[model samples]
Target: MAKRPKVNPNEMSFLDHLEELRWHLIRATLAVVVAGIFAFIAKEFIFDIVLLGPKQPDFITYQILCDVAKSVGLDESFCYTEIPFSIQNRTMSGQFSIHMWTAITAGFIIAFPYILYEFWRFIAPALHENERKASRGFIIIASLLFFIGVLFGYYVISPLSINFLGSYQVSEEVVNEIDLSSYMGLIRASALASGIVFELPIIIFLLTKIGLVTPQILKQYRKFALVGILIVSAIITPPDIASQIVVAIPVLILYEISIFISRMVLKKERKEKIEVKSITKN
Candidate 1:
């Protein structure tokens, strides 16, 4: 295969930059489409084994929760034999539409690393040699954090939310027959949302580098952020305290990590500026 041409930073005009960006975007989209096609081919496994795995009673999250409750000497209500909800398609074309969309979502998730690579490629020309070296592991670290978030969402948030919402009822007369699209939406939302949330530190790092955010500012608004986190948790999980707490813990941890990242970034930037000043004087 022919190697792709590299962008020449100094020689590129505005039009050339746009052309380069267009190709990168095209390549990224093609990657997603190819992955989506594979996901479409694995419809049964995708829908049952991966997407709907959390709804099963034997899901690892439920097992862990059961153990924790037992250790605490609480009621074994976490040990469910079955999830009370039944998922079905109400619209005639719902299943097909969902399959297509879900495949695309899966494709996007699977190809996220490559997408980031393309983004880095676009931005690399604007960075100094030192900056590029400093960010050498950007793709790997960002991808790892994203996958970790995905796992946390799939194994923790999705299962907890499903179990709690699937079992909740106002009266015995109401049957919990969830629509297939609705069920998939919840799983997708939880997983994608968590994946993005896990990028908090990276986001803060960039913002700090660009002088947009600071550790002190983050500290000052910690209480407001707490409220925002709680509200986000409530929106994503069931209104029950257990479910909310389960969702909030990791997010709070990520927020603290973001603060640390901001501090580190600021320190590095300041040190670099001081060293540059010393060299200029010498």
Candidate 2:
């Protein structure tokens, strides 16, 4: 394979910047497509083991929750032998379409670190040498946080929501025949949403860098952020209090982490300003 030519950002025009960005995007998309093909080939594992895991009674999440509930002398709600719903494909192309999309989603998740690396490469040229060095681990940290969030969603939120929604019914006569698309949609949405939500500290850091966010602002709106986090938890997880609380706890912790990050960023910026001032006065 040939290497990509490096372009000096200082000499690049607006159109040159656009061209550079376009190439970065193309490389990122190609990475996703390649990973997607692999995921597509692993259809059985992807579908039966991963995407459908939350709905299965023998899922690890269910087993763990069952054990926890039993140890606590709580109701055996998580100890069920099976969920009360069946998934079906109502349309002719439903399975095929879902397979393709699920592969793409898996590809994105698997290739997230590469995507972030591409993103960093595109932006790094514009930053000072010190800034680039400071953010050297950006891709790794962001990717790790995202995967952690994805695992939380899959093990904690998805199974709980699947159990609650799949078994829920207004009457004994009302059996749920969930559409295949809907079932997969819930899993995909939960995982991806949580992944993005876990980037809270990164987002706060960038906003602080741009002077749009501060530690005080995050602290002042802590209560409001709590309400928002709860609402987001309710939306992503089952509406039950237990499920919502389980989902909200990590997000609340992330919010606190974001505040600390914002404070650190501001302190760094102030120290830089002071150094610049001292050099100028001398």
- The models' CA-based lDDT, in order, is 0.91, 0.91
Q: For residues 130-232, what per-residue lDDT tens digits would candidate 2 score against the true structure? A: 7888788889889999999899878888898889999889999888999999999999988999899999889898888889999999999999999999988
lDDT of 2 at 19: 88
lDDT for each residue of candidate 1 in 123-188, tens digit (9 for 90 to 100):
988999998998999999999999999888888888888888888899999999999988999899
lDDT of 1: 0.91
Please give the TM-score that candidate 1 achieves against the real structure.
0.95
Instruction: Show model 1 residue runs off by greater than 4 Å.
Output: 1-7
List all candidate RMSDs to the true structure: 1.7, 1.4
| Segments in model 2 whose C-alpha atoms lie over 4 Å from true places | 1-5
